[model samples]
Target: MYFTIRPARPADVHGILTADIAAGRTSPADAERFAAGISAAVADPARLVVVAEAHDDANAEGGTGVVGWAKTHHWDYADGPAPAGHYLGGVTVRPEFRRKGLAAQLTEARLHWMWERVEFAWYVVNAHNEASLALHRRWGFREVARGARFHTVAFDGGEGVLLSAARPQA
Candidate 1:
């Protein structure tokens, strides 16, 4: 499906919350809190939040055109293999839009934003998340460490792998 990947806006917060809820990443009861958090991220000067807005024609399900979202954040882990630097924080795509390159596009947008100021990027993933791992590998992210947690970021019932990749040159 066609989508427009761009920097997120205040109006996009609810769409993001919708995506989060649909992906089972957020509970309906916590929607207000989640929306507030998304607002904060949208307003944060130090964070890069991007969203994939589905084209009107592509959103055949009559849902919000916001089909996916992603963000990059500065991580400072005092006790893990990951150092204080920019990281590819996370992404979420609506179920109907999954496996359609939306995730990669969102990731590319964030990486592009980061590469403007840094030479490297980092990310962490659950060891059991083979799909994400494979995607990161394709982006040239190599393993740096593995453990139950990366400082305060804990993996759910599995090991977490810290990965890093250099900025791609044009």
Candidate 2:
């Protein structure tokens, strides 16, 4: 699909919510809460939220709409194996758009943003998510530790793998 990645705007919140709903993450009734959360992130200087907009071949410069989104969250841990830094957040895309490398592209964009401010990028994933683990490995992420919980987040699968990738010099 022809698309471009860019920082999300307030108007993109609805499209992002649509994606989340399509992924079965939430219901349409929760749009207000979702929009508020996204709005806060967009307004925060310490956090980064980006979207991938699909474009028609004939109108590549003007997007058709937001097809996917990814974000990062800053976590300050007073005491934990997970250090205080910006952590990789989740990526969501329309179901029809899965397995097309859109996730990788979104991840690369987040890493690029992270690398500009930190020496290492951190991510915590469920141990059972082999696909995500495999995808991240291609970006140089390696296991730092494994636990039932990291910082304040707990894995639904009961075990989470904490991984980090050093910033590659540009």
Give the winner by lDDT: 2
Task: State the lDDT of candidate 2 residue by residue for 1-170, as single tens digits.
Answer: 57688889888888898888988887888888988999899888898999988877787777767888999989876237888898898889888778778899999999999999999999999999899999999889999999998876798757999999999876
Which 10-residue window in model 1 sums to the lowest lDDT?
Answer: 56-65
What candidate 2 gets wrong by more than 4 Å, as runs, is none
Each model's C-alpha lDDT?
0.85, 0.87
Question: For residues 1-170, could you state the per-residue lDDT of candidate 1 as single tens digits?
Answer: 46788898999998899999999999999999999988988898778899887766556454456889998777654464678888887789989889889888998888888888889888889999998998777779999999888756799789999988998889
Alpha-carbon runs more than 4 Å astray in model 1: 56-64
Q: Which residue pairs of candidate 2 clash?
A: none
Local lDDT at 63 for model 1:
42
Which RMSD does model 2 reach against the true structure? Answer: 1.5
RMSD of each: 2.6, 1.5
Question: By summed lDDT, which 10 consecutive residues of candidate 2 come out lowest?
Answer: 75-84
